[model samples]
Target chain A: MARYGLRTVALVYLLFLLVLPVGLICWTTFQDGIAPVIESLTTPSALHAFKVTAQVAVLTVIANTVFGVGTAVLLVRHEFRGRRVLNMLVDLPLAVSPVVVGLALVLVYGRFAPFGGWLADLGIDVIFSLPGMVLATIFVCLPLVVRAVTPVLEEIGIEQEQAAWTLGSKPWQTFRRVTLPAIRWALAYGMVLTLARALGEYGAVAVVSGRIKDQTQTLTLFVEERFQNFDQQAAYAAAFAMAVIAVLTLLTITLLRPREDER
Target chain B: MATLYLSLIVLIPLAAVVLRSMEDGLSGFWAQVTTPEASSALKLTVVASLLVALINLVMGTLIAWVLVRDDFPGKRIVEMLIDLPFALPTIVAGLVLLALYGPSSPLGVDLAYARSGVVVALLFVTLPFVVRTVQPVLLELDKEVEEAAASLGAGRATIFRRVILPSLLPAMLSGTALAFARSISEFGSTVLISGNIPFQTQVAAVSIFGQIESDNMTGAAAVSTVLLVVALVMLVALDLLQRWGSRRG
Candidate 1:
């Protein structure tokens, strides 16, 4: 009886909160058949929004992968003063609100600020532009890769690399052969998360992008704009597209995740 | 090199927020944060986040217990579904909630554009945090202890309350803290579902966005400073909790 009660509670909570809502979204997207869904998605501006989202996600993934691996390597392989503080700072983005991140970027890059004023004089628009949007995405997604890979790096330890060094392997060769393969899955998992986050980013991107229609609007901001304009179909279609991407990314993470015993 | 990169990317912008907030000195900062708009938004955010975290604590623990202990069909699928919120965009979550329970929906509960709607969206977004946090702890718990308790004739309730509950408490608290932190900072889903009504449904994150949009940079900075401090405190708390959990383990 107790077992049944526990199972029912779990099933009902998930059904109501997770399954039903996502199911409703998928159903609403196709309720009017495929034509409207395609039409809503194929609009020139919608295409542009998707393009912008892709650019941001790709940029975020590259930047995060490089720095994330670098940071994890530094933290696990070496010790330095204030390493603890540095570790905490890596997680600051996760704890900080996305909107606060956007505001911080604006404070640093908006025209009225000192650095922003200097850049504005050179005709470089950071805020309300692609660079600012990318920066926000980077800030928000920073922790994913580091958090994902750090544990793996710790678990694998430095013995393999040390052995490689003793075998006369150069640092680059040692990293390529010894370190990369071990951390590859974790890194991939991190990048996937970073990609998903960048694609769905709205609050920070919304703040920095200026939502200039085809210029800076991402798929998420596009959904918001369309919904507020009473264009419910277009909004739902765009949202559905994002939802598909999210589901696909989740599937990837699950498949790529190390098995329990493996960990 | 890593430190340099981190300083430029992460530390500088954060410092900029603090420096900007101090541009007007303490008096201005006090005035900005103490305004009715700011105060009400802060209060609402705290209240809603607390409620959401508490609810998730119970529900998430229950889910974690089910996942760890039970062997039902489709268990893997159910487990996968728990992480839907983590991968799904917050704005899409808002739209999902709006579609399912908006004013015109057949469900007949007007959750959209209200405080309750804000809580609902927050509930969805932070759902995975607690479950993910507690699930592992529950999994690692030794069944031998429970079996011993059973052989000694302790009831199921007593064994769980005595043996399992104590071990799970730290994880549950940490997960709740994470949920609260995420809830307080959540803007995307809450922005849409809450209607951004100042002094009513306006959460601090959304209100900060509003302040910035309307060109109140100082006010925005002031409010953000408070949120940043709250986040930092939670971060420290989480770090401590993790250390304690590891020690106990």
Candidate 2:
């Protein structure tokens, strides 16, 4: 077959787009000598940003795990009126820009707005607050979990669930005993993606967080802020850490596939 | 109530934009969305997205083909890398491009291309969409067809053109539509790399953000309204094409 020539194009394409950029990021860490990168990572803000990133990621994952599973079951199991609309609505965030997602929150939470005024009367802060950052991240990353699990549920079949229920298993028990393990890999995969997304989200968080240094800034915004501040080493350091986390998460999702179903 | 929650969040803000857009009358709204600035942004977005998607079509098809057709060293790592952008926050993708082409970066200085830099960055981040979408199609492609084509003395190119490409085209179209929708609203990566220079680097989505910040809701809504229309139309067109292509297949 003349497929041999096509294979060359495919390999080169992979090398240029996927492999090279990752390699470039890795090389960037050591490009200006190890000292700068090392020193940058050691900085308290850089260290702090990494800790916050980890913390936020963990929180986002746990929240998504529950929410994702619930939403998936709601989406797949419940055949209600406007089911199609609900499906599309869940994925609306995917089509909207993260910036708009942030604005949506702002328009809801601005001082003059209904919710914001009440919260402010109580001295509550959202814009430029930790809550704002998490809310925006959650908004942007909402679809990933839903998308990951719904497909698995449909493809896995439901005879097992019916059998469990027929055998007198409670509704929740049927799901726990018969369905959870079936989609656990998908759950894990979605969690990893969500973790990576929360750590790196900036557009939504940027508009909402107000880029307040150290308090609500994410590693991504931290990198951008440092770039504007002309702190290249710190920017690189944050980018490097994010890159590491991304590569690791990507690794996890691909390696641990469920026994059945395509990823 | 299912749609009720969605309408409050998704439909209300969107409808406000549309209502205000037509409130000024159709001609005025047309003028607003088709101004030189808006047209250039629209032109760049559509043309650039098409260019990027076309490029990814070939690249994605090839990557998918290789992964399914052959085994290689670090195959799993290569596969993982292909999906990296999907996991990446658009902002992180933008950050990488900024590092790649900021005025300080060699690529930035050497290229001497001002606005195309934004296109380059957008293309980089959006590259994954088509690739990820097309890979499964390629993976599930029946290898037996190729063998049958080979036995019929069909050349590899002929086999692919007649056998594989035709089967994959529907998926590619659908994937490209998804990629187009994604690239249009891609403010995070483009904002940093483009520097948001008006009439040049400023795209529709960025302009919306600019207007919102300035409290020019009318103007912002106009731009966003155009984007919304384009997104709806593009998605519809893609859906029709995919349906037709699948039926033909």
Candidate 3:
């Protein structure tokens, strides 16, 4: 109704940019009989990949939550040498190529590197192991939690924290009672972003992951291996499952973010 | 403690990639990454990234214009959907493109070139950043000037060209730089659609990492150095432009 032209372009852009491509993927996934797709998705490798993805997501969320909360607090409250550099370094992993992150870890943890021999002798197996995949996820996903929490911490300001301190609440108790409640939404926001990212990650995790079937294979890597092996149905099915989770997580984030009314 | 953890996992390994390359003399390292294959991968990466960035330059600005200038239904939804790619896993983006442009797809079957699929893959993954970066600037734009241009009997095209285009130029350039920076490092999506073929569709990020998988650490280091240097230069350039834009603002 509004000059029709702008609306048409908006529709076309959305169709091309978001709807059609995602729709096409969902359609192909359900091809070859829904049963076959479902069966493939339930297979051990796909299941393991999903399970591993969940485990890594959980571990990463836990690790980065602590790291993110502490970083936001330290960053907002403390002044120290190299604080600016530290702030910049914290954001580096966000922009670092996942391929680079993976390869970097592979070099350090693979059999040829110095740490690899020590780890191998200890039977710790970092490369091509579950631990390695989780570690890579943590490295890449670290920035999300920090990004979410830091902005909120800055927004809420330090007046309340100072008030609690003035009220003679112990440092730990003030942090726990006053600061944590104020930042809970930001914390949830950060954790959700980490979980979503850890789920979809491929390159870095794939490199150090070794893609061991039913073991080290994360969902994204599993999809790649399946596609490369020309198990197209399995790949599509797994991709569909991942897409569903991703879309849900995204919607949740959008819903939880400060609304127009809130602002 | 977390910083130490991050340094061990990220910074040290990153340094190691550079160190391995420099262990060979600079000339020797340069010689390795300058091979015909490496040259072609770099070429492909630059061209594809530029193509993606340029396309997004037009489309992103239009979307930003729509979001900023117009009040419409589903505006918030559109804003969030624009951000979908940022959180969308790159691998899934690749898969999405593969599903859209593989041989069986309606357009893929009739495309001018066989490798149009790779372009589509790069396009989807790189589109959102350009859009996101530009959208914020567009929102933050001082609109009185554009409205003034409109009242002066300037036609739509004239207004866009003479008024809006100049102001949006810096953000567009910075966004394009970011788009290129991002597209070059793109491996997850490219690897899926390119079929990992060497010397043709293979990207630098993929090829360099492929060397790592094969334990050709020295050779991989050489290629990694090239990518690292290129990325560092581009990032520094982007930082300067961004600072310049902020200062002027």
Candidate 4:
């Protein structure tokens, strides 16, 4: 009886909090049939938003993957003075509000501040441009890959790399041949997480992007703009598409988990 | 190379925020943080986050316990649902909740433009923290101890309170702290639902966003500093808790 009661409570909580809300949005998106949903997604502005989201997500993932693997290897294998502090600082981005993230970037990189002014003089715009949006997304998604790969790197140890080094392999060769194979799944998992976060980022991008439609508006900004302008259909449709991406990411993560665990 | 990226991307910009907040000295920072609207928003955020954390401590633990100890049909689906919040876009999360609980709520339970609406949004975004934290510890737990307690005639409640709860508390608290920090900093999920009414449903993150929109950079930076301090403190606490948890285990 107690077990049944607990199950009921858990199910009810998830039903209302998780399942139902997501289901309702998907249902609402299609209530008017497929034409509006498709049309809403294919509008010129919507398509542009899609392009921007993709470009930013891809760049962010590539950057984070490199940074994540380097940081993980450094944290797990190398000894350094501020290693612990670096570990904690890697997590700083997660603790920050996305809005603060935007504000932080703007303060340092906007055209007014000293560094930003210098960059502006060089005709290199950082804030309120594609570079700003990418930077914001990268900041918000920075820790995912590092966090994911660090544990696996720790478990793998350095014996294999050491053997390769002893056999005359160069630094890059040892990493490419031995270390890379062991951590590939974990690295893949981390990239997936980074991609998911990059694609979903809104608040930080909002502050930094300047939200000029068809220019800086990513899909998330598009959703908010559409909803605020009373374009509920467009908002819901864009939202539904994003939701599908999220769900598919979840499924991919789930599938990858066992394989990640197997090694 | 890694240090270079971390310094440029993560460290410098954050330092800039702290420096910006101190531009007018400590008094100016204090004044910005203590404005009636700013203070009220900060208070609301802290209170709502505390409430959300306390609730998560209980409900999150319960869900983790069920996932580990209980079995039922479609359990895998429930497991997948647990991470949906983390994976979903925050704006979409706000929209979905509004669809269900907003003005035109099919269930007729309109929470939009209300403080409760703000809490619900935080809860949705933070749903994964505690459960994810506690589930692994529960899985690693040995059943032999419970069997030993049962053989000694320990009641179910006694076994739980004495045997299980002790081991679970650290992970539980860590998860709770992470959730609290997250709720304090939450923005996107609360924006549409809370309606951003000052001294009402507005949270600290939304308050910061508003300050930035109004070009009150100093004020925004000051309030942001407060949040950054709180989040840093929580991270330190989390570190200590994890070290303690590992030591005990």
Top candidate on lDDT is 4
Model 1 misplaced regions, further than 4 Å: A259-263
Top-DockQ structure, candidate number: 4
**lDDT score, residue A157, model 3?**
87
The C-alpha stretches of model 3 lying farther than 4 A from their native spots are: A1-10, A259-263, B71-77, B108-115
> RMSD to the native, candidate 4?
0.7
What does DockQ give for each predicted structure? 0.86, 0.46, 0.56, 0.90
lDDT of 4 by residue, B1-249 (tens): 998898888789989999999999999999999999999999999999999999999999999999999999999889999999999999999999999999999999999999999999999999999999999999999999999999999999999999999999999999999999999999999999999999999899999999999999999999999999998999899999999999989
Model 3 steric clash pairs: none
Q: Model 2: how far is A82 from its true place, Å?
A: 0.6
Deviation in angstroms for B217 in model 2? 3.6
Tens-digit lDDT track for model 4 on A1-263?
99999999999999999889999998999998999999999999999999999999999999999999999999999998999999999998999999999999999999989999999999999998999999999999999999999999999988898999999999999999999999988888899999999999999999999999999999999999999999999999999999989988998898888998787
> Would you list the clashing residue pairs of candidate 1?
none
How much lDDT does each candidate structure score?
0.91, 0.73, 0.79, 0.95
**Model 3 superposed RMSD (Cα):** 2.5
If the candidates were sorted by their lDDT against the true structure, best first, what order would they fall in?
4, 1, 3, 2
Tens-place lDDT per residue, model 1, A181-232, is 9988898889999999999998999888888998999999999999999999
lDDT of 3 by residue, A120-220 (tens): 89889888888788889888887788888887788878899889999999999999999898888878878888888888988888788877788888889
User: Distance from true position, residue A20, model 1, in Å?
Assistant: 1.5
Error of 2 at A51 (Å): 4.7
Chain A TM-score vs. truth, each candidate = 0.96, 0.90, 0.93, 0.99
Clashes (candidate 1): 0
